[model samples]
Target: MAVKLRPAGILLAAAGALAIAMPVLLLLPGGGGAVPRAAPVPAPIGAGTMPVLARVYERPLFGASEPVEAPADAPRLVGIVGRLNIDAVALVKASDGTTRTLAIGESVDGWSLASLAIDAAFFTRGAERVRVPLPIEPGGSEAGTEETGR
Candidate 1:
């Protein structure tokens, strides 16, 4: 019997030879193989060195100190619609004798409405705050009483 080689057989032999040699070549020394290394550890921060985000978290979102009394020239609270603190609206009489409607955080005549209650509205200007009471009628009822039913 005579041995014969075909294109397909030659290609199969070449592939098998390469497959067997690859692992032996990789295992040889100085073959530029990857070496396992320990992971790097991070250093601890010093007490004097605070991150920017840490400094921001240390400050208060709103001013926490007690506010001074408001000035006499501040606007007067006329009436308040709605009793809830979050959704209440305050009517104020400005120094110029004009009526203005304000909500929490709204500004009138340089004063910002900081909070609201059923009978009072608080306004703030810088470090000063004023508690403007709701107007009272002659019948001993607060203003807007008929509307709010309180």
Candidate 2:
């Protein structure tokens, strides 16, 4: 007795094979059809608008003090650009050195003291909502330029 392959099964197998080959075909270069290494690809940002990191004052939320290292679409970008800084000012007279006081932004203050729920933003799903802690300092000035984390 010989096993007869059904047409539906054959079609399904063909479909599966095609589905698997789709990526391979796409990766193949036009000329020699060479398959290169699969590198990480970031999703496209909004049209005419890219992801911007929110930054206020001297410190940046997504990058170091360096100007070029900062990331765009950061929460600090929103706060600074929007100029929406909401927090109280605490003045304390210290007997230490000069009259230098430590002032933190509302978001930073909230996060540091466990006042607000602050979690590292993860881009596993998508760039829907990337919450970043606002600047920490009473009169944090705005810094121009934005950067995006790759």
Q: All candidates' lDDT scores?
A: 0.81, 0.39
Task: Put down candidate 2 lDDT per residue, 27-91, tens digits, no spaces.
Answer: 77773366588989876776457444443443566744653322343223122211113442322
Measured with C-alpha atoms, the lDDT of residue 30 in candidate 2 is 77
Q: What's each prediction's clash count? A: 0, 18
Per-residue accuracy of model 1 over 1-150 as CA lDDT, tens digit each: 999999999999999999999888888996647888888976766845756887888776875545445478888887887767557798899989999899888998899999987778888899987777765779886544656545
Off by over 4 Å in 1: 1-70, 143-150
RMSD (Cα, Å) for all candidates, in order, is 11.0, 19.2
Q: Give the TM-score of candidate 1.
A: 0.46
Quick one: best lDDT, which candidate?
1
State the lDDT at 11 in candidate 2. Answer: 100
